[model samples]
Target: MRWNRIKRRNVLETGYDCLNGIPLISLRYAIIVAEVLNFHHAANVLGTTQSSVSTRIKGLENALGVLLFERRHRGVRLTEIGRHFVAEVSASIAQIDHAVRTAGAAIDGMEGHLSIGLHSPITAGFLADLRRQYRASYPMIKQSVLESRSSETIALVRGGQLDLAFVVGTVNASDCHSRLLWREPIVAALPLDHPLAKREAITWLDLAGETFLVQHGGTGPQVFERVIRRISERERVPRVHRCDVARDTLMGLVAAGDGITLTTETTTHVPFPGVVFRLIADESESARFSAVWSPHNRNPALLNMLDLATQMSGAASFMETSNT
Candidate 1:
């Protein structure tokens, strides 16, 4: 009768529209009652009074305009329509619960997506170790990496295209928050039989006049500038060749004795046949790497990653101090 009254006032409304008006609490009560087949038992499980549970079920049945349960002297049983309704509602409630849990995990930085931009090779070193630890700690968070030039990575961070960027030098962008994570000593990549390869370490003077090969992308320009600054001061002005190629390809050319190139200590971990790596003994030969991100970006996963990096950087500094 109540349904008839509501239906009369809204003649064009669909059945789904009417169902939408029913409160979730009443639907849940109906589901519980159907599960236990007794109002008193369902009330006990729900931590409520039997009369309250019975009233909610009665209201839910009236809203549907059908008897959902057949009451007996001892308990109750579901009608055919009631069985179908309960099954559907149970599945929907399960989905709602899952959604709530997923949202909460994302908020807590335990699950979500993280996009990182970097110019450095993560084959070995702090960045590589950091990635491994982050994946272990937040296995549910999806990670993507973009390797580009330092300038491009910084631009991506400011535009909100990347959650974080690690680059080879201190970032001084007003729109970005930056932190110096670590410095890697510069190393020279040389053909194994080259005269300088036998040295434990080499100096800028040692490389002065040697033909230097650098790639056009990634840290190539930076290496070229450093080579010029360090070698040109003596007025010996080295012969530098800029090649359009990948880092690995440049290393191959170095192996073939095309020329020598500069790299950070982390890259020395990867072995190139016919090539050897030697550290530059000059104090200024190390490259300082910094992490950059936009201050306005509020991705929880990004925050978590930054926190982890800070911890790892601090630990590494402490270890270095102890060793010295």
Candidate 2:
């Protein structure tokens, strides 16, 4: 999508200028200039040079064919055209400020809906408590949760389809905002009476020839693939039996001695007959889970959800610490 072709009807209009043959500067810069009321200050605020600000203003004026400022001994003053422009700019700024304050208030007020997209591993334990508490605290606010792969969750959040998500593994996104929630090392899962299950901690080399079970898609598979690739250095990639199932089901399969799997220590709950989780001896490859969202979201409920997620992460940390 070309940014130059982007236009809005009732709010903004930018297209090929038939008169001055120059494109319009965005309202963002206009708001900055109006606030400072000085080219240098506006430039400084906008992280540009004074000359650049003057050039942009000139370009903007030429594009509209309207003089927006009157120079004086003290400083530049708004001309008739400038006065009219300032009013519109000021009104827009006021509306924006009002919207921001109102949004903040709504987040604090605990109103509106929050849509959450998260990978399956996170949804199993502490996150459930967070949903329960958040609902109890704010009965008025509506919440919807979607379980998906980390990549898909991040994409949805970035695209504005989801308000927030818990993502694992590396995030290649540059546009969306992210916060580190917690870091937990991936542990090796083995069935009861399994040879390696007796060990306190195991390494990739320890399971060199063992059959491995890995989640099918998203960060789970990616992480497993990385470990396998590294381990395949002196030997073939160990026989990996991939499974498409929820976290609990995966654990059940491991308990049933289907195959060993790697997952976060916090995700080591064994609801099935026999299962044991052993920490990985390697610390460098430890996985970190992050809470991510788009900064452009104006919804207050989403902000509250972020805070709630943080709290849940904290609780999970305490639980893990106690377990260890």
Candidate 3:
């Protein structure tokens, strides 16, 4: 009669106090028993003895102050109250289990999100290969990429807007951790009829008096600075036309014979109808790409990506040495 009165009270009325002394194991046992309707079968499925299962269910009923099952000669059947209790308990237990699994996956870097900023095209080269391998290895990680100027990419990493950034040249931020992952040789994108295009490779000096078309985004500014640094020593100022455009559009300008632009080896993978790519003869001219991230940021997905990049960088270096 007392339990009947208590049970009549709304389940939420007791709030946290009601379930304070209840063990999750007892709740689980009740769910199993309700499913199988036989104490022995439920115990078997739970890998426990029938008596243990029965005791747990009894404890759960006492804790809830309500009868959950009616014992019969054949097995057991749920009472009207038992059915409602079990249904609610089943859904709650499922949600708890899912929450536990999702938390664990996030901690282990198996499921999470990663945002990366890039200054170079990922159409081909080490960064491209690394992206493919990372995706295959951690399929659950939601990855998003944004292409911007090298300075902007590094700024995003420092400002915590980006999880990681692949940028040209070294990053000198005190708040960020940076590692040079790879280097790409500088190349010139010239029009088909450009006199220098006939050569297998051309030195930066050959680019003298030629108008250089560089974009205002991505690696454009860096490329412009590099051109000045390389050709400034010859007492000749490089004629550079900085245009606000994308890399592809800059390449299109080169094809239209507007002006030649500079790029890295990776961009050569894609063909532009009237554009030709030639390596800058100066071997010292290269773009050192680095990965930059905030030291204070502890995104597990970002850690996993850095680890993979380190491994791939080592392997790439080994392969290059072996080839030589």
Evaluated with lDDT, which candidate comes out highest?
Answer: 1
Which residue pairs show backbone clashes in model 2?
none
lDDT of each: 0.82, 0.68, 0.81
Q: How does model 1 score by TM-score?
A: 0.86
lDDT of 3 by residue, 1-324 (tens): 112222222332232433578865676667778878999998887778999888888888888899999999888999999999988877765565567678889999999999999967788999999989999999999999998877787888888999999877776666777887887888899999989889999877888778989887777768888878777877798888989987778888899999998888998998888999998887485677788888878899999998899888873452211111
lDDT of 1 by residue, 266-301 (tens): 889988898999988884756878888888888999
- For each candidate in turn, the TM-score is 0.86, 0.55, 0.82
* Candidate number of the best TM-score: 1
RMSD from true fold, candidate 1: 7.8
lDDT of 3: 0.81
lDDT of 2 by residue, 207-314 (tens): 778778787775566657766775786376667877787677887888888888777766675345688888877646656666677767778777776677667676
Ranking by lDDT: 1, 3, 2
**Candidates sorted on TM-score, descending:** 1, 3, 2
Q: Which stretches of candidate 2 lie over 4 Å from their true place?
A: 1-109, 121-140, 233-237, 307-324
Off by over 4 Å in 1: 1-19, 233-235, 315-324
State residue 273's C-alpha deviation in candidate 3, in Å: 3.9
Worst 10 residues of 2 by lDDT: 1-10
Candidate 2 local lDDT, residue 184? 70
